[model samples]
Target: MLKALSLFTGIGGLDFGFEAAGFTTIAAVEANTTVAATIRLNRKWDVLETNLDPRRAVDICSSTIIKDAGPLDIVIAGPPCQPFSKAAYWREDGASGLDDPRSRTLNAFLQVIALTRPKAFLLENVPGFAARGHSGGLDRVLTGITRVNSTFGSRYRVHWAKLNSADYGVPQIRERVFLVGAEDGRDFIFPNPTHRNASGTDDDVRLPLYTTCWDAIGDIPSSSDDSLRMKGKWAGLLPSIPEGENYLWHTNRGGGMPLFGWRTRYWTFLLKLAKDRPSWTIQSQSGSASGPFHWSNRRLSATELFRLQTFPQNVKCDASRSEMQRMVGNAVPSLLAEVLACEIKKQFFGAKLDTSKSPTLAVPKSETAPRRTAVRPVPPAFHELVGTHADHPGTGLGPGAAAGARAKRDALRKFKAA
Candidate 1:
C-alpha cells in the first residue's frame, strides 16, 4: 500500500479522502488541541501534536520521528490560508497588501516535501492564494520546491487550478486552489468535472447534475439545539425572506424600509438555502447573525453543516458547537478531496481510474419548486413586491432595478428623517 503523510491535518479530512482512495496514512501533523483530539479519536496513524509554525523550521525526520516510516509516496498539506483569504483581506483595517505571517506556513510545507522527498505532494489553499498580488509568493514557493527536487536528483513538475467542491458532488459552492507536484516530472492534470451547474444546458446528460443544498441535508430532521436558532430582531425576518435570497430582499424596493441597499451586505447576511442550488460556503466562525439559514429559516446545525461538508454521517466530532463549526468550515470537503485523490492514485500510483465507485447523491427532482409553504408568510404588500422583483434578472434584480431601488432608498431615508 502507498504511504502518505499529512501536514496541517485538520480533523483528517484529506487523510480520510486519501485513505478512501486506497492510500495508507503513516503519520499526520496538526497543532490545534481540539482538532488533534478529533484526529486521534478517528485515525490510528501517528498524530504529531505540534504546531507547523513557519517562523521555526520543522525537522519532520527528527522532531516528529517519522524517519522510520519508510518511503512516503505522497505528502499532502493545507497551509493556513488567512494571509490570502478574501475575507481576511476585506477585514484588514489598512492597505498593507498581501504580507501576512501565516503565509510562512507555505514555506514550512515545502520544507517537509524537501526533507521527506515524497514521490509527489499536494498543497491546498484558498482561491486567493493564486491572486495577482500573491503571485510573487507563489513564485518563491515554486522556486524553493524546484531547488529541493534538484538537490534530491529528481525532476518534478507542478500544476495548479481553482476547483469548486460542488463540481465534485459536494453540496457546497466552495472554491479552492490545489497545487500538485510530482518527482517524476509528469505534469498533473485535474480530474474532469463530475457535475455541472443545475442551470447549465450542456448536451451531455451522462455528466451528473450539481449536488444541491437539499441533496445534502433534506433528509436530516431539523435540530432543536439552541445553537440552530437565529437571534435578534432579524430572527423573525429571515423566515419571511425567500429561499436563496438575502437581507437585500427586505430593502425599501422590496416593500421593506431597511436602511441597507441591495448588494451592500455580505452574501451570508440573511442568506438562506435554495433547495435547487448548492449551499453557500460554510463559514469558519458564525455568530447568531451570520447565516446561511435553512430554508426553514433557522441557523444550520453542526450535524447539518457536516453533511454539507461531505463528512461521513457516522463521524462524530466531539467539540463545542463553535469549535465544530470552525473545523467543518476549515476542512477541505471530503468528497472534493476524494475526487482529487482518486485522480492522483491513477496518475501517479498506477491505480485504475474508477468512476463506478465514485460517491454520488440523488437530488430531488422538485428542488426548484417554490418553497412558500416552508416558512411563515411575508406581509401581502411585501410578498407582492418581492414576487415581481424576483422575475427581474440575476436573482431577479438587475442594473435598472438598482436605480429604482436607490431612489426608493433615498425617499425612505427622507421619510424616516421626518
Candidate 2:
C-alpha cells in the first residue's frame, strides 16, 4: 500500500476515502482538537494536533511530522476554501487574490513537499480557486509543485480538473477542484465519474434513473423539527413521498415544505426542477452566505449533507449540525479519492503487481481495529442527472461551461513563468 500523509485532515474524510481506495495514511495533521479527537476515536490512527493556522507552513512541516509519516509516497490535503470561493463576499469587489491567510495553505503543503520529498501529492479545493483573476494563486501552486519536483529529481506534473460529485454517483451535485501531481512524469489522468445520482426526475424527460432527492437518503424517516437527527420534510404541506431505505432505521421521505417560505411554500419552481434533475452545485457556504443548498426551505440535515458528499453509511462524522453541513459541503468525496488513487497506482507501480491491492500488512487482531464497511456502488440510474446552464449569484456553478477554463490555466502557467 502507498504510504500516505494527510494535512488539514478534517475528521478523516480524505483519510478514510484514501484508505478505502487502498492507500494507508500513516499520519494526519489537523488543527481542530475536537474534530481531530473524533477522527482518532473512530479510526485509531495517529494524529498531529496543532492549531497553528495553516499559513504557518514551515512550522507544520517541521521534521517531526515528516519523520512520523515516514517515506510518504503521497500527500493529500483540502485547504480551507472559504475566502477563495465564489460565494465569498468581496469576491466580486475586484479583490486581488491570495490576500487572505487561508489562501496560503498550499504554500504550507508545499513546504512539507520540500522537506519530505514524496513521490506524488493531491491538492483539493473549491472551484472558485480556478475563477478568473484568481489564476495568480493557482499559478503559484502549479509552478511550485513543478519546480519542487524538478529540483528534487522527481518529475512533477498536474492534471487539474473540476468534478461534480453528483456526476460521480454521489446524491448531491457538489463540485470541487482536484489537482494531481506526479513525480515520475507519468501522465496523471482524472478518474471517470462513475455515477450520476442527481437528475431531473419530476420532468417527463425520458431518461432512465438519474438519481434524485428521493434516491440517496430517501429511506430515512421524514425529518421532524424536534429531532436534531431529522428535520421535518422540505415541503411540510406537499404529499409525503418515499425516497429509499437504509439499514432499517426508518422510512425516508421526500418533498416536504421547508421552514423558509414566503408563501408557506418553497420556491415550487426550483423544487420541481431539483426533484428530477441533478441539483446545481452543492456549494461551500460559510452559513453567512445564502445559496449553497439553493432551496427556500429548511437546510439539509448533517447526515443528509454528508450523503451528498458520498460518505459511506458506517463512517461516523462528529460535528455541530452547521459544522457538519459545511464540512460535507467542502470535502473531496472518498469515491473520487478511490478513483484517483487507483490511477496513481497504475502509473507508479505498474502491472508487476499493485501495492494498493495487496493485503500484505496483515491486520493485527486487536480489540479496536477500525471496522471495515462494504462500499455501496453508484447506482446505474445515477447517470441520469440532468441540468441546464444557469448561474444565479451565491448559488450553483458559473453557467456549467468549462469552455475556456483549461485554456485559462495554460495561459496562467505562461504568465507565471514570465
Candidate 3:
C-alpha cells in the first residue's frame, strides 16, 4: 500500500477517502485540538496536534512531520480556504487570497513537498483559489513545485480541476479546486464525472443520476435533540421558504412576500433542502439564520451532515453542535477523495483498481423522496417587514462593496499618516 501524510486533516474526510482507495495514512496534522481529538477517536493514524503554519519555520515544520511519519509516498493537504472563499470577497476589505497571512499554510504545504520530495502531492482548496485574478497563490504553487523539480532532479508536472461533489455522487453540490502532480512528470487525468443531474432536463444519459438528499439521509432516523431546533429571529421564517429555496423565496421576484431584494442576501440564507434534490454546500461558519436546513424545518443532525459528506456511519464526533459543523463542513467529501485516490493510484503508482466499480463511499440511490411539506404563510409578525427594497446593484457595486472600498481608503490613510 502507498503511504500518505495528511495536512489540515479535518474530521479525516480526505484520509478516510484515500484509505478506502488502498492508501494508508501514516500520520495526520491538524491545528485544532478538538478536531484532532475527534480524528483520534475514530482512526489509529498518528495524530500530530500542531498547526502546519509553524512557529519554528516552514522547513522546521516539514522536518517535524518527517520525523514523526518518516518519508512519504504522497502528501495531501487542504489548506485553510477562508483567504479565497466567497465570504472573504464580501469582507470589509475584500478578498485578499494569498495576501491574507492565513494563506501561509499554502506555502507551508509546498515547502513540505520540497523537503520530503513525495512521489506525488495533492492540494485542495475553495474554487476561488484558482479564480483568474485571485489565483496568485496557484502561480506560487506551480513555481514552487517547479523549484522542487529542479532541486531534487525530479520531473513534476501538475494538473488541476474544479469539481463538484455531486458530480462524483457524494450528494452535495460543493465545488472545490483539486491540484495533483507527480514526480515522474506524468500528467494526472481527473476522473470523468460519474454522475449527472437527475433532473430530467439534460439529454446526457451516459452517467447515473446525481445522488440526492434523500439518497444520502432518507434512511437515517431523525434526531429529537433540542439543539437541532432552528433558532433566532429568522428561525420562524424557514418553514415559509419552500424546499430547495432560500431567502430569495421571500423576495419581490419570488412566490411569497417581498420582504427582501433580489441578490441582497447570501445564497444560503434560510436555505432548506429538497428531498428530491442534492444539497447545497455545507458551510463551516454558519449563522443562526444560515441554512441548507432539513426539509422538516430544522437544522441537520450530526449524522445527517456526515452522511451528506459521505463519511462512514460509525465515525463519531465528540464536539459541540457548532464545532462539529465547522469540522464536517470544512471536510472534502470522502467519496470525492476516494474517486481521486483511485485514479491517482492507477495513474501514478501503477496500482490496480477495478475501474468499473463504484466508489465504496458513494451513497446508495433511493427511488423515492419524502412527500413535500406544505409551505406556510408568512407569519403576521413579519408582514411589517414587507416593502420595496432595492436589489443589489452588481458585483463590486453593491452596498457591501462600497463599504469595502471606504474601509480600504481609511486603512491606506492611516498607513500614510503613520
Residue lDDT tens for model 2, 22-83: 78888778887767876776786678787435355566666475676567788888878776
Q: What is the RMSD of candidate 2? A: 11.9
Name the lDDT of candidate 2: 0.56
Which runs of model 1 end up more than 4 angstroms from their true locations? 54-57, 63-65, 93-98, 203-205, 252-259, 360-418
Model 3: lDDT to the true structure: 0.87
Q: Assess the local accuracy of residue 285 in candidate 1 as a C-alpha lDDT between 0 and 100.
A: 78
Evaluate all candidate structures by whole-model CA lDDT and list the values in order: 0.75, 0.56, 0.87
Q: Estimate each model's TM-score.
A: 0.84, 0.67, 0.95
For residues 193-257, write the lDDT of model 3, one tens digit per residue. Answer: 88898554456587888889999998878778898899999988888989999999888899999
Off by over 4 Å in 3: 54-70, 93-95, 199-203, 413-418
Compare candidates 1 and 3 on TM-score and give the better one.
3
